[model samples]
Target chain A: MGNLLEIKNLNVQFDIFGAHVQAVRGVSFELNVGETLAIVGESGSGKSVTSKAIMGLIPNPPGKITSGEIFFDGSDLVKYSQKQMQKIRGKDISMIFQDPMTALNPTMKIGKQIMEGLIKHQNLSKNEAKTKAAELLKLVGIPNPDKRLDEYPHQFSGGMRQRVVIAIALACNPKILIADEPTTALDVTIQAQILDLMRDIQKKTGTAIILITHDLGVVANLAQRVAVMYGGKIVETGTLEEIFYNPKHPYTWGLLSSMPKLHAKTDKLLAIPGTPPDLSDPPKGCPFAPRCPHAMKVCVDHMPDYTKLSATQKTACWLLDERAPKVDPPATIGVGGE
Target chain B: MDESREKLLQVKNLKKYFKVSRKDTLKAVDDVTFDVYKGETFGLVGESGCGKSTTGRTIIRLYEPTEGEVLFDGEEIGGKLSTKAKKNLSRRMQMIFQDPYASLNPRMMVKDIIAEGLDIHHLVKSDKERMDRVYHLLETVGLNREHANRYPHEFSGGQRQRIGIARALAVDPDFIIADEPISALDVSIQAQVVNLLQELQEQQGLTFLFIAHDLSMVKHISDRVGVMYLGNMAELAPSDELYDHPLHPYTQALLSAIPVADPKVERTRERIILQGDVPSPVDPPSGCRFRTRCPFAMEICAKARPKWHEAGKGHWVSCHLHDDGLKK
Candidate 1:
């Protein structure tokens, strides 16, 4: 199948205190229709920035797209005007934020909040919008949708508030939904419920999804394809099986090993030492070279080229460099080690 | 695995009710009882507002218990302790808060924060001695001694947490209550903090009541785990047994909800998505608080609260499904 969305050679930068901070650099990926693509990274790894760039949500003045082409349905979105982007934002692409309490307006009733999108995008009348809003609430599994529509945000629980947010996101029937850590604030059970709800909705509407999260567990079950991001770049990209079973990047290995497994029997977890590098004055070569376990002398001197492991898998690491000697990941990492 | 010794920390029918309004009392923690072994990590796992944090605070006397006796080292705390006695007992217990960012004073330097406990207890004689103790505490938590002079804002989130650990350790307490210490940290940094706590527990022979929202991490670090729901403990068991054979329906649904990192396992595993949100703590359900959302709830569940009793060796559950064996 052809790609639904393709982002090639993307670069995003911010001018802060008379210095350019390269947030995202040379990132490339493709999302197929009806596929759930996950972008996983720690804070300041530019995972959110990449998603924001794709949605044309980057705030102007300080934030700028340095160089890249974001193609949606064979049309470059980077060239679209603000007026043009506004029309496509809620109608073609929708985003769900991390905190639902803050994302939702406290004063307005949830029914009105959801109806704003339907009336604006679908051009529904007041009464028609209210009726459609209740239907959307029911679709998102809100109990007694008609009665609860009159209730304010404070009356709902954390999980229920998120369900309302999901309802708002789906009000316009967008072709793409970008959920940025929608479940991070919720408990495990509620997180599971929200993930399942998203999967079910995606199946029903055939909307492509971009799930952004720091938790690898969410990506493992929800996403069809996985993109491991680090230091403003796609360090590794592959199918879920290939990423989980045979990961090629050391950063991906650290992520897998650092996660506390529910079934594994181990005394101590293997933590990756050191923090993410400073983005203001990034290193000359590989961005993750400072924290990589298999860091070589050449890694500091030159950036490793992207090596194709398969038609669907690729990694950028010195260990994968053809001239470099093969170095295996630790034995403790079960599936993703050589 | 000795089970015959006197309990180190015994809580009897603990209750912590918060008055949200004049007419309403939120039962944040209601009618809970448990025991922590001498040198084991007792984990409290639950969702938000489930009274896990309240239970920990009530045990430590951070929040005055509405009704309960917290027997620590064979002595019941709260109102019973005289002023001098409370001061003496303060040296034996300490607590690490959840949010490292908000818990630490941004204006104070790291040394003063760690040395606050030492100064309170009068552990050090001179200023130099206090600085030495503070530096040693920083080193013990895998932080550099040079960071002693820096402010909390100068460090990263993980580093601030290390400072929090340093502060908790300065008192050299026998028991520590880590209330969701790693929940606020990054995933990569969480393991580091957990490992540090494990090592500290072993070296100091300190008992811990680790309260967290993540069940997988709780299972990894805790010897015994307790599952709480709306101010009541649903089940308590050994870590391995709790993960392997969860008896309570709430626990089964909880364990099933943890998303595995493997796609194959995730696709194949059946997830029991609970239908409703957690009932409000204020004016909670009449009998079993979890009955409102429980899939296997029976009619009797709403009539009376189930008795919390031992179902098997080292396993306890509070549910009506196990009543047949109890009756027999």
Candidate 2:
């Protein structure tokens, strides 16, 4: 009901060499309490950058949140100092990184890794942290938590290591959990297990989640709401049903249609022509205009404002405008069989 | 359509075991058998450590077959052959690796990377001919002549993959082993590569052994699909029949495991989440390799290997549940 995190026009940039790469261009979204909001996009679509900016994990030298505000818990996180962010990071907002294989420290014991956050954030004693760490491991469906605590990361399988990563993120019992491609590296069956675990954990803890992924299937499985991002901007934001069944943006359509349904009858996929625009010299107007089939002259010349389609759905496309020609979506766009 | 066509490649009891240590051997592709029709994409789907990639590599002669026969064009190509025969085999059967960035030579220009096959086989006559062929190959894969002069670093992931396709096509191979070719590319870009592969297959009459973990894409492109688990072929049938009426427990579990990109379907559909992870490849489960994780695993599944026999018309499966003799 209440907004847990509100990101308003967040802009992140990387000054590599002399050219400036606009990673996140005026992105805005809100995460409601105890809701799963998935940010779906390809690589370099600014989903990860936006999540990193929320946690103050952006490296200052090359990468910086150049503009915009990250309002979390009624405070502007944008103005927060490094020391201030460090205290709030593990305690109130926790993150499960992209790659579980490299996320955990290979040399450190799994118990110590989980306990580090607990001790630092909750100010728990060494013995208390150890007990809590074991409990967290068991909660994440790891077998023999007490015995497994002493094991190193390499000793665990890929799926078990990911469970350990989740345990660490859940160690402090943070109010908000940000999982970035948590199941990408795992197999589909293992991914299904992890997704089920996350859902069960969310139901128990009531922790709001920001799930960043490229796989739309994973999004459909876990997320209640979806944000379609392309070329450093959020092109469409809607409820899961709206995005999957009634999408507006051409990029969203392309993304949905590009992937074949498991029982898809079509022989060829309706692939979006060309590639994503270079961030260093991004397009003048809509980022997806180059690849969009319904791109009008106005689309290339100027960016379209977000048109409110429904109470929960909004899209930034010239096709949604009243004056623009009404173009119907492809017959194969909707994912469901019916 | 497939029965009438000749078999381009027949893999009979193919085995590729790697000696991890003196005692332990990793059976990467143990006694895997399948046939690729003259002009069809034979999709091989499996999870990680399932030996799909190893099977593809073994067929292309990247890794020598530890045991078994690989008959390509009615000739026994798997056995030890002369250097000239090996060279000729390499030209006839090309490979496109998974990682486009790592597969392509970063040091060399795109022209040279694509022309490497041409240079190796001495397909071109002169300097002009080599350059011309390189340019033509680049265009064939949707890239321009200008891109040939540039290095691999300058291209995007999708472009690099296109370049990889160009390199494979440079030799004009009859069969191509595309091992996870579109896995590295973006979601939107993956379709482009898939469409490109389909077009190339149609135009050139190329027979492909499409190896990937992505089930949906495999079903879309492949004519006949094979399911593999722990270096063993679980099921093999036409793509439609394989997906619609999967007989093997492993194949059914695998098909259900995939998350479809539909909110209504994903929310309502029941998923068969297999307990535990895939066992270590060094020492896989005995008898039926899938028995450990299979929900419908019977007692006999652990005692003896299931016979790899035809379940339905053209649908081959290896499972005790499908074994009529065992059922009796």
Candidate 3:
């Protein structure tokens, strides 16, 4: 499959008063056709910032894409103006936000909202748009689609509202769908339903999916490949098994061990100590060096480059250095997938 | 860990209904029953609007129970209690709120905020005594006395939760109801707070009624757990037993839906996806609340509410399939 989207050395910054917050620092990745790529990170780790930067949704003046190129359809989106980006956003790449209530207009009917994109991008008439909207709703597995199209945002449940939001995102058959924690706002059962529906949609449409979430479980559940971000940088990127089974970076290890599992009974979870580094004045060396358990003396003085583990896996960590002392993840910690 | 281990708190057929309109009653918590043993953590989990929080609030007498009994230490304290008795009850049972930022007063000093319980019951004789108590609590929850002068906004989410834990411990209560205590914190910080809770429970011999929507985290810390759906207890059993042998369809769905962090298991495992959202508690279904989303739903499920029974040893479940084993 061809690469649907490729981001190269992307840098994003926000100026809050006199201080500058480096939100995304040289983050790069690729999304291939019909493949799911999950970006996993904690808050302030720049996971959400990377997704927003891709959509050209970052507020300018305050938030700016300072450097790098976002290549989609063999073109750079970083230099694209607001008007040009609008066309690409709806027709080429669409995003489904975490909260459907905030994303959807409360007063408008569900059908009109779903049809707006179809009518505008596909050039369909009002009656034709209505027919397409119903099909979209049914595709997202909303029951009794014909009668439900007339309902408002509040009339539908949280899960149904999220389903409607997905329906809208798929209305134009966008090439790439960036779902920013799409199921985070819904319940677990509903989250499963949404995740299943998204997988079904991807299989049918062969759409490239970019799933952004803080939950490692969700990443495991959906993504074919995983990129673990920490302090605005892609610390580790690999196939799902590499990230889960043989994660090298201390940050990725900490994240995986921090979460308590369903099948395993462990006395204590290994929490990563300390908070994320301040983006206003980031650390001179590796940003995660402060909290890294396997951090070496050189980690504080210099940042490590990505070490290629395999064709699909690369990790940035001082522990990967040949000269550094060998250290392993704590014994009590487990993969505990089942 | 035995049958006669002593029930620290017994909630018998409790109900708490709010008057939404003059005629319409919002049944936030309907006839639910459970017991918290001494020094055991009892986890209550459900999705939003399932009355898990309401049950915790009602047990602490934050809201007056509309019906049924809440017996603590063999004394009924559900209805109209004397002010002195209520004040005494407050000292015996304290609550840790879900939102640390909103729970702590922004204008007040951390020391004063944590000592709010100390001053209420007149637990301290002098200012030095109160300060000493506050400082001791901070250290107990992994903070130092240096945090006494700061405000709630000064701390991060994890630190703020630690301060919240300190506030709850200042009263030296027998039972602490934590309402989604770690939900507000990030993943890295969640386990820290959970560890702290477990440590304090061991040190002080405290009984916890942990309320949260996260089933995985709840399963980690809870001794026994109860599954709630639309104001009713769908299942209740020991944590391991419940997770290992889930009988109720809702419980099975809830457990299966939790995404495992390992990709191999996630890809291979069969997930049970419920069909619809939780029905409105105001006009709940005639029988089981889960029948709307249950995969093994039968005609009898709608006809009558399934009787709560012990399907296996120490595992209680409410489902028509478990009502009585029969040829279908």
Query: Candidate 1 at residue A323, lDDT?
Result: 80
Write model 1 residue lDDT over A143-222, tens digit each, in one string. 89999999999999899999999999999998889999999999888898899899899989998999999988899879
Model 2, runs deviating above 4 Å: A335-337
**How does the DockQ of candidate 1 come out?**
0.60
Query: Model 1 clash pairs?
Result: none
Model 3, B1-328: lDDT tens digits are 4798889999999999999988789999999988899999999999999999999999999899999999998889998999999999999998999988899899999999999999998999999999999989999988879999988898888898898889888988999999999987889989889989998999899999999999999999999999999999999999999999898889999999998888888989998888878888888888878888889988888888888777777788888888766424
Predicted structure with the largest lDDT when compared to the true one:
2
Q: Which ten-residue region of model 1 chain A has the weakest summed lDDT?
A: A329-338
lDDT measured at residue B27 in model 1 versus the true structure, 0 to 100: 94
Candidate with maximal TM-score? 2
Rank the models by TM-score, top first.
2, 3, 1
User: What overall lDDT goes with each candidate model?
Assistant: 0.89, 0.92, 0.90
Off by over 4 Å in 1: A17-19, A334-338, B325-328
TM-scores of the models, in the given order?
A: 0.97, 0.99, 0.98
DockQ of every candidate: 0.60, 0.82, 0.78
Judged by lDDT relative to the true structure, which candidate is superior, 2 or 3? 2
Cα lDDT tens digits, model 2, B132-196, are: 99998888889999997899999999999999999999999999999999999999999999999
Candidate 1: give its CA RMSD in angstroms.
1.9
